[model samples]
Target: MNPTATALRAGVRRGVIELRQSLTNGADLWNHAFWPVLMLVVTYFLRDVSFGRTGFTVGALALPGILGMNAAMAMVTMSQLLTADREDGTLLRAKATPNGMLGYLVGKIVHVSGGLVVDLAIFLVPGLFLVPGLVTGSPDAWLTLAWVLALGMVAALPVGAVLGSVFSSARAQGLLMLPILGMIAISGIFYPVTALPGWVQWVAQVFPVYWLGLGMRSALLPDAAAAVEIGESWRHLETVGVLTAWAVLGLVLAPIVLRRMARRESGSSVARRREKSLQRAGM
Candidate 1:
C-alpha cells in the first residue's frame, strides 16, 4: 500500500516483462545465444589439448573461468542498457514520475542480473558435457558456484551502473568495450594468471574479473589444479576480501553518481540528444 513498495512492485513487473521480451524477440534471443554457442564451439576443439602439462584439458580449465568472466560482464550489460535508456528519454520519463528513478534502477538490476543467470546456464549446461575434470557431482562445488555468482553480481553490477552513469552517449559506452576486453585478456579467462607477467597479474588482480575467474576455478577445479595458481592455493579468503571490497566501494559510490546523473536529465535535454542522434544517423 505504501508508495515505495508500489514502485518496487512495478519495477519487478517491468523487469519480468523485459526479460520475457528478451526471450521472445529474435534479436535479443540471438544476442543471448551467440556468445555461449561460440564458447562451446571453441571448447569442443580444445577438449583434447593439454593445459601446460597439467594433464587437464584446456577446455576443462577454461570453462569455469569463462563462467566467472561472463558473470562479471553483467556490469557491461547494465552500463550499456542504462546509456541506451537515457539516450532514448526513458530516464527523463522516469524523472517525471514519483520514485521513478528508484523503480527504473531496480528494474534494470533485475533484468540485467536475470539475463546473466540465463546466459550462465546456457554456457554451463553444455559446458559440463564438453569439459572434463569438473567436480560437478559434489555438493560443495554447487555451493561454491552459487556464492561466487551471487557475490560476483553484487560486486560487478553497481560498478557497472556507475560506469553507465558516467558515459553520456552510446558511442562512449561502446568505447568501454575496449578496456573490458583488455581486462578479460589479462584476467586469466582463457589461461592461468600465473602464466602472465608479474605486472599484468597485479593489474588483473586489482579488478573483479580476475577474482571472479579465480573463484570459479577454485569452485570447479580439483585440488591438484591449485598447483598452477598463484601461491599454489585457491585463496578463497583473498577472493572474498577483494570482491567484498569492490562490492562495498560500488554500493557506496553508485547512489551518489546515479543521483547526480539523474538530476541532469530533463525533457529538453532528452529532446536535444534525440535530435543530435537523428542528425548523426542521417549524416
Candidate 2:
C-alpha cells in the first residue's frame, strides 16, 4: 500500500485505541456532552431575545458557532494529548520505525475527527427538532453550514497541532487558549458580529474564527443582510481571503514545525519532562 494509505490506516487504528481509552477514562463523555448541553440550555432560555425580529434562535445561529467551538475543542484537546505523548516518549519511540511520523499524524487526525463527529451529533439532534429558526430557513443554508464546519476543522486542526508541538509545558495550554478564546468571543459565536465595534470587526477579519462565523452567518442569516444599503462586503470578503491564506500557510507550516519538534525530542529528554510533570503533580 502507498505511504499515505498505510499512514491513514495506522492513524485510524490509533484513533480507535485512544478513543476507547478516553471512553473508559470519562474524557470522551465530558467532551462530547458537557459544552453542547450547556449551550443548549442557554440557548433555550435566551430564545425570547430578538436579533431584529428574526429572533435569537440558538438552533439557527448557535449550532454553527458550536460546530466551530467543536473544532476548537478538538484541536486543543488533541494537540494537548499529542504534547503529552511527546513528553511521555511515545513519539520519540515511534520515530525510529518506518513511516512512524506519517502514522502518528494520521492517528492525531483520526482522534480529533472522532471527537468532532461526537460534537456534531450533539449539535444536530437539537438543531433538527428544537431550533425553530432553522426550521424556517432554506435547505441550502444547512448545506452551506456543513461545508463551513468541515473547512473550519481543516483551518483549526493544523494551527492547534503546531501550537501543541511548540508549547512544551502544560501551563502554556492556558496561555495558548486565552487568545483563541478571545477570538471566539469576537467571532460572534454567541451574538451578532455587526453589534461589535468597527475595530473589533476589523481585528476579527484576520483569523479563521471570523471566516467560519461569516460563512456560517451567510448560511443562517437572511438575505437582507447581504443586500444591505452599505456594510460587510469588505468584511466578509476579507474573512474568506484570510481563512484561505491561513489554510495554505498551515499546510506548509505544520509539517515543518512537527519535524523540528520531533528532532528535538529524544527518549531521555521526554523521560525527563515526564518526570518533571509527575514531580510537579506530586505523583
Candidate 3:
C-alpha cells in the first residue's frame, strides 16, 4: 500500500475506535447532531411551505441542497472536534509519536467520513419514504447524488482543516458558528438563487456551498435551469472550478498555519495560562 494510504488507514483505525467510544458515551454526537439535522429539516420544511401548488414537489429540489449542507456542517463539526483535541493536549500527545500527528489527523478524517456517510443515508432514506416524489427515480439521479455527495465531502475537508488550525482556542469555535450559519442561510440551499437579493446572490457565488447546491440541482432537476446562478452557462463547471480552487488553496495553506501553531506550543506556557484561568474562575 502507498505510504500515505497506509498512514491514513492506521490513523483511521485509531479514530474509528475513538468514534465508537464517543458514540456509545453520548458525547459530542448528541450535541452536534442537532444543528445539522435541524438545518436540513428546516430547509426541507421551508421548501414545501407553500400550500397552493399541487404536485409542486419541492422535495426533489431540496435533497441535493440538504446533502450539500449536511456535508458542510459535518466538516465544520469535525474541525471543531479537532480544535477541541488540540486545546486539551491530545494533539500534542499524538505529535510525540512517530507519524502520530499524521495518524491523528487521519483518524479525524476517518471519523468525520463516517459521519458524512451516516448523514447521507439519513438524508436519502427519509427523502425516499417521506418524499417519494422527491427521490430521484432514475439511476442517473442516483449517480448524480453519489457524485455530489463525495465531491461535497472532498470540498469541505481542506476548509475544515484550515478552520481547525486557525481556531485553536475553544472560545473561537463559538465565533465560527455565525459565519457558517449565515453562509447557509444565504447560499440558496433552501431557496432559488434568483429569489435572493442581488448582493446575497453575489456573495453566495464566492463559496462552495452555493456551488454544491447548484451542482446538485443540475443533477436532480436538469430543467430547473433558472434556479442555478450561472444557469448552465458552463453547466456545473463554475461550481466545480470554484470548489476545487478553494480545496487546493486550503490544502496548501492549512499545513503552513498548523506548523506555525505547532511551533508556538510550550507546555509550560499552557500550564501557566491554565492556572491563571483557574484562579480567575475560583477553581
Best by TM-score: 1
Separate clash counts for every candidate: 0, 1, 0
What stretches of model 3 exceed 4 Å from their correct place? 1-6, 36-59, 225-234, 276-282
Q: After superposition, how far is residue 234 of candidate 3 from its true place, in Å?
A: 8.5
- Candidate 3 lDDT over 118-201, as tens digits, reads 656756565555543453667887786677667777778867877887775666789988999899988877766666788888
Candidate 3: global Cα-lDDT?
0.69
Give all TM-scores, in the order shown.
Answer: 0.97, 0.87, 0.85
Sorted on lDDT, best first, the list reads 1, 2, 3
Best by lDDT: 1
lDDT score, candidate 2, position 210: 63
RMSD of every prediction: 1.1, 2.9, 3.1
After superposition, candidate 2 runs with Cα above 4 Å error: 1-4, 20-25, 52-60, 135-139, 225-240
Residue 122 C-alpha lDDT in model 1 = 94
Off by over 4 Å in 1: none
Model 2 scores worst on lDDT over the 10 consecutive residues at 225-234
lDDT of 2 at 62: 59
Q: Candidate 1 or 2, higher TM-score?
A: 1
lDDT of 1: 0.91
Give a tens-digit lDDT track for model 2, residues 47-84: 65556664345345655556566665666876787787
